[model samples]
Target: MTAHSPSLTPAFWDASIARAEKDSGVKVKQVVAPSTGRDGYAKQLQASGQFPDLLQSITPSQFTDGGLLKPYDQSWIDQNFLLPQGNAIKGKVYVPPTNSQIIPLVFYNKSLFVKVGAKVPTTWQQFLDVNAKLKSAGITPLELGGNDPFAAAMPLTGALSVDVLGKNPQWIQQRHAGKVKFTDADVVTAATKMRTLVEKGYFEQGALNVSYADSIKNFNAGKAAMYPMGSWYLGSIPKDQWNNIGVFPWPSDDGSVVVPFSVGGSMAIASKAKDPAGATKFAQKWSLDPKNLKALIESDGAFPMLKNKTLADYHVKVSPAFTESYTYVTKTNTKVSSMGWATNDEALPGTGNDDFYAAAQALFNSGDVKGQMAKLDKSWDTATK
Candidate 1:
């Protein structure tokens, strides 16, 4: 009955738990994990050997590979989960997405577009044209949270990956399989595209030092024309300026690419659940029930993955920007995870993630497209090996 911090709890969790317990007549106790780091939580789980019946915020890979979770039934994933990458890892449905995530979108100030006399761009060339117009009008064309390494890489990789790796959606798996290299010409093109943006002064001043919150503040204050982030950002916009908000898919060379879909939202059931049957029922309701899923999506500004479910199904008032991003998700069939998803040690180094973020920081700051990529390739090879 233990869980992640209440602050980080998903919107639908408490209600779902209450409903599940009422239906099943099982009294559940909620234990809060210590207010410590992720690894500390894992260590605590191990030392206590009391893995919560319903695990939250942990990926399937982390739990399954660690021998802490039971592999989920394939039928459960098939009938209940609308996973972006399908519902299996290594041919087993160990973990499926808790909710779909629409990432790497460019949210813009519609008024700024009007002032600069630019339409929402659909092609890479048009995107550059719009950037020029924004700059000419004395507006920062892009507001990036560069001080936060992952934030800096989100839009860069999102746009660049589509242009460079769009032809191969499974490029990450391929790279891991030793069938491709990060030093490919297209990969360099993608990395260099970001350098080109810096060279053109399209980004806001001191972007290299700005935090995500700072970038959001700058964008909302009308200091920038475009802010590229995930759909989750919709709720953070100030109500007074909400009407001026709009969204566009990141433009690509031929307009054939779409935003890469990622599924970071997941919950797993521990193998050592005290009441296995009850835990299974709760997990199913939390992930599969259309009503609960809808709440999660609407409340968190995530893309819905329920069968035949669309944004129209949720009748709540939502920002136009959210609707536009969902439309993009529905229209585009091509999707992918960021590169680090494939690289094992791909998170921030000390936090049990990896070194990719730091390497990406080098790429952005050094503008040494080739040199940085070589370093990245070496790191990836070592990690995958």
Candidate 2:
């Protein structure tokens, strides 16, 4: 199995392997893969004739397109999976949904807000004001891990969530169907907001040099006032700092809560597995295993994607910050597919996510919102062709 490197610790993987071996009688080996570039590790392994039997955390679209993945039985999926169609490619289930997460959440430092006399912001202007206050107090207004392309793109994703998907959840689908372009007014506004933050010097110096792990460490160590990240960040916070952190949805211009979220971390089986049936059984067992699910929730702050399951059903203690964000999303009932993430029906073609990330990083550094948008449109067109 190819697993996301930071998603779980070594001990957790060891325990999971033991559990799966005991339950399914199939030995499991995990390869920790870097969480940079779109499915680069998987594609590299496939090119070298060393692709694993089970894939985790890697987006399956390219593999599915190449007929390298085995499709799951529809009846089995219907009986077990909550979002049965979440990882479908061309009317077939290529990956089994494992968990859900709300991306683009602003996990902020509560003490920093108090120190700067700033309150949680609900509108776009208020959010900027809060950042200005934090900056005036000599605090880095935002923490970003720009060394990792995905992390670098997150702020833009947050902005786009509010300015684009918040108003029209179908924006991605429209773009996919050739009815819209990245240069559209709403998209330009979103990109401009992200560039505004860059121009205001709201992010930490040398953010482009910080790796994802170090950024998380810096945020937890109180070096930054805000970290705009996904809900999964809830599990990465140290226990002692739990009470000092708070979360809010990415602010919108009109102050309405609109979260960008996706059901993620699904696994796919290789079509050429030596033991296809055995691999399939193990995938099912691993995904639905109670112990595995509990560990994932406790360590990754993952929301379950199984039928009749909720975070409460896991019975694991979570930080209050997570509860607040989760409650806010649930109450608002306003969520859209997170841009650049592969959803059930809206998987980006080829290296579309990589292109989007590259464009976002360029915008973050140069503040060329229009040029980046045009670059993204070009890349999108090329990928589709």
Candidate 3:
């Protein structure tokens, strides 16, 4: 079966497939899916007529619209997929999401927090207060990789919308359907928070030029007190610095937690798979097999999408940092998926990812929250109409 994913290196993919093959006795063929990104992959799938046996990065909506993916029967994945709110297509399971992964975590240096005498901030105001204190201590309050621009805005965007969207997860679908506009007051409120942070100098100076890797390095080197990033950053952090780091959810207005979907790469069977049965077996084994799933969680910091165990059974055993983050996730009953997921390629025209990313960057640079909202609303209308 052909597969494409950005999550695993070729070596890791080969090794994982070999292990799955050995355990499940499923003869899986590893064919190239695509070298291009998500949009490119979609086009390639269209050109090829037959979708790859498995795809990563591409969403269910794209495949479903193209009539290239097979729906799943009732199984553990069908029941447990957390972001079903965004992922399902007309009540059908087309994209069976694998390992659960949380994003936009406020990863901070514990030592820095203690040095500043700051408690974990539970609300937006408290969050700002802690940053101000950190800045007073001559530490960069937040190390952001703004050179890559949109990618840098992502974590904060997730943080800002969690409170607004968490309470109204369907706002994403509503916006796509043109029932809601991007210029809505609530949308503007959530977006303006990031502009406010920039205006107040809560992030490091010259953040607009810093790359994501550079931001991570700055945080690890003690140049900053906090770094908002995805849980995937876990694998990249050096082991020696592990004890000094702690992760928490982005503080909300009322201290209520709002988390976006924590899904890792999803797996879907191509309608044209040479080994359809093998593809299904591999998908089930990769997700449900306790041994494989645990290894993925430990090695990659992937949250288990399958909720077969208690918090103690799953998170505490992973690592100190993961335990902290996942504990918040389970305890808060955090909502999955966000506007970030809303603007994918298959998204309604004006609501595509490029438009969303551009809107986010412009907010930080221009500080015209309302104006940006108007522009975004216009873009949505133009594209969706």
Instruction: Indicate which candidate wins on lDDT.
Output: 2
Tens-place lDDT digits, model 1, residues 1-385: 3344333464445666677677666667666655455435765766776667776555455555567776677776766555633434566654455555656778899998999788998888898999999999898999998899877776556754577556777676666677877678888887777778888999888787999889889989989999878777776777788789998777888876566666654456778888787777766665554555454455567776666666666555577777777776667467655444421212211221245556556655687777877776787666545
TM-score of each prediction: 0.89, 0.85, 0.86
| Overall lDDT per candidate, in order of appearance | 0.67, 0.81, 0.68
**Superior by TM-score: candidate 2 or candidate 3:** 3
Q: Give the TM-score of candidate 2.
A: 0.85
| Cα displacement (Å) at residue 311, model 2 | 3.4
Supply candidate 3's per-residue lDDT for 362.
75
lDDT by residue for model 3 over 1-385, one digit each (tens)?
A: 3343444557656776777777778866565655556656655656976456776556566557667888777555547654443355666666565456666778888999999899989888999999899988888899888877555666446754586677676676777776777677877788888888889898889887888788878888989998877776666566787898888877788888777654444567777777888887777665554544555566667775555565445433455787776665556475646455532322435355566677767766797788877876787778657
- How many clashes in each structure? 3, 1, 5
Evaluated at residue 383, the lDDT of candidate 1 is 54
Candidate closer to the true structure by TM-score (higher is better), 1 or 3: 1
The global Cα lDDT (0 to 1) of model 1 is 0.67
Q: Measured by TM-score, how close is model 3 to the native structure?
A: 0.86
Stretches of candidate 3 above 4 Å error?
1-7, 22-25, 33-46, 79-86, 290-300, 310-318, 342-351
Predicted model with the maximum TM-score: 1
Shift in Å, residue 310, candidate 1: 3.4
